[model samples]
Target chain A: MKAIVPIKRVVDPYAKVKPTADGAGLDSGGAKFEINPFDEIAVEEAVRQKEAGRFTEVVVVSVGKGECEEQLRKALAIGADRAVLLETQEPLDSPAVAKVLSEFVAAEAPHVVLMGKQATDDDNNQAGQMLAAILDWPQATFAAKTDFAADKATVVRETDSGEETLELPYPCLVTTDLRLNEPRYIALPGIIKARSKPLEKRPLASVPAPKSSVVSFAPAPARPPGRKVGSVAELAQAIKDRGVF
Target chain B: MSLLVICFDPSELSQVAGFGASFGTYDVLLLTGEAGNAGASKIHVANLVEVPPADNIGKSVASVAANYTHVAAVSSMRAKDLMARVAGINQSAMITDVVKVFSETEFERPMVAGSVLARVKAESTPIVMTFRPAGFDKTVPGPNGSVESISISDTGRVKRVSTSARQGGRPDLSQAKFVVSGGRPLKDAATFEQVIGGFADKFGAAVGATRAAVDSGIAPNDLQVGQTGKVVAPDLYIAAGISGSTQHMAGIKDSKLIVAINKDGDAPIFDQADLGIVGDLYEVLPELEKALS
Candidate 1:
């Protein structure tokens, strides 16, 4: 069995996200970049499965500019056997991201494809499910618990009342949720070893680009300070009185 | 929904309010399947959709869609079978999950996330775009667009296989009453165990989480309450190390009472907390549990 994990380079969550001058996107300048934390969990989960001998090879794929290769290396250091970087410089939104990913996954033909539920930079959280749809495969979102056995996955999901489980066949797409597991850190030795492992770079010439471009992309405006009341009970009363409740 | 936007987090709804009200041109009604931390708003009177006691994703959407004429239903860009099922319901779907809008006569939604967008002319009045929902000027207080009852049809586009018999596992943290949340300050799981464990045990609360913790693999996504995850209105929401992010706040905005137990005085959780304990969860939680006991 094989597992493929898709990762993205996103704005580091710790940094303050200021709006771009144009108000269309995040001004990531001078901010640090990191492997999308949610995607790290997906990578970790796949690597764990491989380490347990529950699966065979692990392929780490990153879709972004060449900078994403560094993210792939982090996956490699964590435990991925190899890396593939889909090269492009443009800001590819969620649907476009999924389209490129679907094309790549089809060629790899792994038993399962996993990704973070959503990339923090974009926060759209739609690509994984869209990829599943494009592949005409089963998809699961917000999975709290997942077990792999007999080439099938049993995933516990969120509902309004309580948790429910879904049994999906292999070759489906799954996005990892935050509660799934804690990711392992890369030891210094593993980072050194990751360099020796193969890292493949592919151009978007073969990758599909969405025909439409963003008419606009803007940052969300800051909310006014909630009339900072002295106490929570007072806050609740204010909210109720203001009729925002 | 008359016009839908996928809101996994409560702050996303606020963002929607900002987008719709500030940049929007239409008098649209915002309907959240569940209103997040902000709680119920008179501006957007959100309604809860009923699902069959045991059903797959298809049945859940179908049951909800049955209640309306459903000119179009917006789903998350990641909703695999949302449009296919809507098509199966015999509603001509202009399916795109990317950022999209209404073009007066036609509804334009992004076909592939935010890649290339497509325009679907609504030969039928209510056209559905799965991903991008149009921004509203403001949440108008009015009737539910006079939604009439409708029945499911056999469109035969594609059908999802049912997995109800086996009852696969999925977490419903969105519904939990007591959530023990963590943040960047929590450092590692070993340290978090004492604080979160004590809080969960004392209040009998399920753990709540933020996107920051969830992404780091310290917390599971289902346990995360934010704009992109589940929205929980628990009885007691306790924040151990969380610094309230606007996005993360959406999930727990509906929580009945929020307690911030942190070492930092400036943590955003204090701004919204009913009870702000400006101290360490490491010190406060054990003491809190002991006091309760």
Candidate 2:
């Protein structure tokens, strides 16, 4: 069996991001980049499954510009046996991205695909579901836990109501949620070894144009500054003043 | 032009109605297992399709795609997940967690964990989107509109095995007008329930917790409030023991009134709260509870 993981490079979650002065995009200058946290978890899960002798290989795939190769290498260091970069400079919407991935999945025929539920950059949360739709495959999204058997996988999903478990046949897709796993940190030796791992690069294949575009971005409106009351009594009075008591 | 609003929970009909109102005049496609009135020109699909456990509701909606110029649902996880796939199958454009609906093709939504807002235009037909429940007021129930029933074959392949729902009598965090949330400082589950849960019950509020608290097992995952969890815009939001991570702040930024109670005065939540009390919650909570009683 083979497990494929799709990873994305996003602005570091810890760093502050601002809208570009032109309001067309983010002011990414000087911002640090990292493998999207959830995708890191995906790579970790795939690696764990491989370590358990459940798979022969764990392949990490990324779609982006040259910088994305850096993230692919990082995924290798984290435990993926190989990495593939769909090098592209074009801005691809979620559907376009899904189209590219679905094509790749069809050719690769991996037994299972694991990816982050959403990328922090766009927060679209569409790619996994879109890929499932395109591939006509079962998908267990927002997956917190996955119990695998020989022919089926049971995924515990984190839903709005609570946890819902779904059983799907093999050759399925699962999107990682926050609680899935804590990604292991890459050590110096792992980083050094990652440089020697197989990293394949291929140009992005042509796909349909994206139908949606970002027209403008604006800073979120500021919240009114808070006032510190001396005691609980004052806090109660404030709540009462707001007619909320 | 008509609008199709996929119904998940019956209570979500009002949010769908608010979304449909923006289209001037539209029809609602209510999809559910049971039938009910939704105060709109409606088509009820009781078991329109046999939904496989692993299949999304979007597949069924997309299969029946018809004359509607817009398709919408409340921005819950299930709805957003389904609508996104529907958009993919239709090769249409979709925007999620929309806060403003200017037209069938234009909308505004938050990004960067709600720190930035983007106004987007979908230059495609049959726009599919999900509206943030907090962004619009629930429409008042009107005279019953016409309801028609239709059925379709189920193509779902996934099977649901089990569900472990969080047991509670409190109001849903998303629908509640008042909320009381806890953070890491709450310590353990017993204290979380006794303190935060106690306060929520006292004020007739919903219970919420920061991701930190939920991750630590002090609260159930469903009670989490943040960019990754549930976004709430209640009338009153009280943050106790929470330090207010940016993602956590993203969920409550829209609350009409915010109160923070924490021992450390420098917690970021204090800056966002309308009123803040810098003291031990162990002391403050009981005092406030007594005062309210």
Candidate 3:
């Protein structure tokens, strides 16, 4: 069996980024970049599955410009067997990205596809579900815990109200959540070994037109400055003044 | 344009209806309970099991996709997941967590965790999206609308084994008008609950916690309020002990009024708060609770 994990290159989650001066998109110049935090969890889970001998090969794939290969290599250092970069200069929406991934998955035919629930960049939270729909496969998203068996997987999902458990047969998709697993640190030896791993780059065979496009960007409006109160009684008075019980 | 609002949680009904009103007269697909107050021209009821998996719900919604020019739902994890499938099935444009609807085709949504807001345009028909409930007001209830029963078969491959929903009558974190959130300083679950939950219970406010608190196991996963957790925009939000990480602030930036109480006078939360109290929560919260009583 083989597991496919798709990763993305996004601005570091901890770094504070802003929109470009022209209101076009993110001003990522000189900004720190990393594998999207959630996708990192997905990569870690797939590598663990491979280590456990459930899958012989774990491949990490990404769709973006050539710079994306850097993130793909980092995934290799973390234990993925190989990497594939679907090179594209065109901006792709969640639906278009799903279309690209579906075409690749058809030829790869992995038993299971693991993905991050959403990227910290766009935060669309759509690709995995859209891919599952396009592939006509079962999906268990926001999975906090997943147990793999011969033919099916039991997953505990983090929902708004609480947690839910779902079972899906093979050839299914599972999107990782925050509590899934902590990614292992890439050490010197792992980084050195990653250099020898095969990093394949292929031009996107077909890039579907984006259904939705960003028109402009603006910095979020700031909240009015607040005043500090002296004590609890003063705070209570303010709350009462606002009509809050 | 015919808009079809997907109604699930009753608390978010008016918000969704109010948003749909911007697009003109709309109908509803009632998934769970009554939406008599939705103020829609028509309510299409779907016969299904309780809390059906989003995969099944998405398939059901897509089956009737041809009837409306647009489909929308209140933004939530489940609704976003379901709408993605519907978008895929119909090849429609999909947008999530829309904070502003400029028109039927244009919208503004936050990116990079609310630091930047991007205006987007849907270039195609049958647009599928979810609007943030906090960004809009609840629409007033109108005369009862006609109801039509619709058959939606379960065509999903996933099966639900069990669900352990959070207990108690606390209002939902997203819909609550008043919220009290705690931070990591609370230590353990018992202490966190006694302090934060106790304060919230005093005035029937919903309880929330920063990601730091949740990661430390002092709070349940559902109570997390941050970029990756639940986004809340209550009328009044009280923060005790939280330093207000950027992600945490992103979740609460929409809140109408914010009050922060932290011993660290330099905590970032105070910068965004409408009222700041520099003091120890241990001493201040108890006194504030007493004052509220």
Candidate 4:
């Protein structure tokens, strides 16, 4: 069995971002780029599953410009067997990205597709579900723990209510959550070995145009500065003043 | 344009109804539980008493989504999952965590956490979206809408083994009018609940925790309030012992009034706070609880 993981390149999670002057999109504020933190967790989970002998091979896939190959290589260093990059310059929204991934999944026919629940950039939390829908496959999202049998996978998902356990048959999709596992730091030797891994780059196949686009972006409204109170009674009065008490 | 508002949580029906009513005459797909007066023209309910897994319900929604120009739900983990599938099956446009609706084709949502609000336009039909209920007004209870039974097939491919529901009866963190959250300084689970939770009980405010607190196992994952956790916009947010990481700030930026209580007066949280108290939360929270009482 083979497991496929799709990762995304995003602004570093810790970086502060702002709207560009024209208000069309965000400025990364000179923040470094990295594999989206959630996607990295997905990569780590897929690699761990391979190590456990549940799958014979693990392949990391990414979509976008050539720069994405850097992230793909990082996934390789983290223990993915190989990497595939569908190079494209056209900006894609969730629907279009899902369409592209569904096509790839159909062709690859991996038993399981693992990915992040959401990308920190858009934070749409949709691709895996959308891909499952297009593929007509079952999906378990926000997965905190996953146990795979020969033909099925039981996943514990982190939901708003609490944990929910779902059992899904083979050829399914599971989106990783933060608590799934702690990703290992890539050592110098691992990085050196990544250079030798097969990094395949192919032209992005034709897909439908994005159905939705960002029209403009504006900075979030700022909160008024606050004053410090001297005592607990004063704090209680402040809370009372807000009508919250 | 006609709208079909999907709701799985009966408790949020009024908020969902209020949002849908803003777009015009709307119908509802009540997936589970009981709903009170929601003001929807039609309340289409499924057979189940409890909400089914997302994939099962998603197929049911996709099967019927084409009948309306807009399909929406109050944003939640499960709803977002199902709606994405609906969007995929229909090959339609979708926007999640939407904060504003300009028309059937236009909407506003936050990205990069809540630091930026992006106005988005849907160039396709049956715009599938999830609205942040916190940003909208709850509709006043009206007469119960007409009910219609909707058939939902259990795909059986995905089986729900169980659900460990969170401690109930407290207002949901996302919908609470006031929130009291703590960070790692609160320490272990017992102390977290006793201090932060105790203080919150004074005002009926929901208790929240920073990711560090959740990661350290001091708090439950559901109580995590940050970029990757639950977003809150309460009228008053008291953040205790939190230095305010950027991700945590992103989640609470929408809050109406922020108050920070920490020993470190220069903590980043104070930069965003509307009021602050530079003191130990262990000492301050107990005193504040007493004062509020």
Could you tell me which residue pairs clash in candidate 2? B53-B158, B54-B158
Q: How well docked is model 3, in DockQ terms?
A: 0.84
- In candidate 2, position B46 carries an lDDT of 51
Write candidate 1's Cα lDDT for B35-85 as tens digits: 443211222323424222111344444445444333232343223334433
Which ranges of candidate 1 are over 4 A from the true structure? Answer: A206-245, B1-223, B231-242, B245-247, B250-264, B270-293
Native contact fraction, candidates in order: 0.02, 0.83, 0.84, 0.85
Interface RMSD of predicted model 4: 1.0
lDDT of each: 0.57, 0.82, 0.87, 0.86
Per-structure clash totals for the candidates:
44, 2, 0, 1
How much DockQ does model 1 earn? 0.13
In DockQ, how does model 4 score against the reference complex?
0.83
Ranking of predictions according to TM-score: 3, 4, 2, 1
Please write out the lDDT profile of model 2 over residues A1-245, one tens digit for every residue: 89889999999886777798999888766878999888998999999888888878999998879899888989999889999998888988888889899888899999899999998877778889889888988888998998767899889999887889898898999999989988998987888889999999998766567778888999899897979999888878778888976
DockQ of candidate model 2? 0.81
B138-252, model 2: which lDDT tens digit per residue? Answer: 6764644677776644555777878777766889888889899999888899999998888788878899999999888899889999888999988888898989888899899
lDDT of 3: 0.87
Question: Judged by DockQ cut-offs, is candidate 3 incorrect, acceptable, medium or high?
Answer: high
Residue A206 shift from truth in candidate 1, angstroms: 5.3
The sequence of per-residue lDDT tens digits that candidate 4 reaches over residues B1-293 is: 78888888677677875677678678888787775677888888775767777777676778777888899988888787788988888888899888888877888898887788899999989789998876777668575569888887766668999999888767889888889999999879999988888778777889999999998889988888988899888888889999988789878887888889999988988888988999999899888888878
TM-score of chain A of each: 0.87, 0.97, 0.96, 0.97
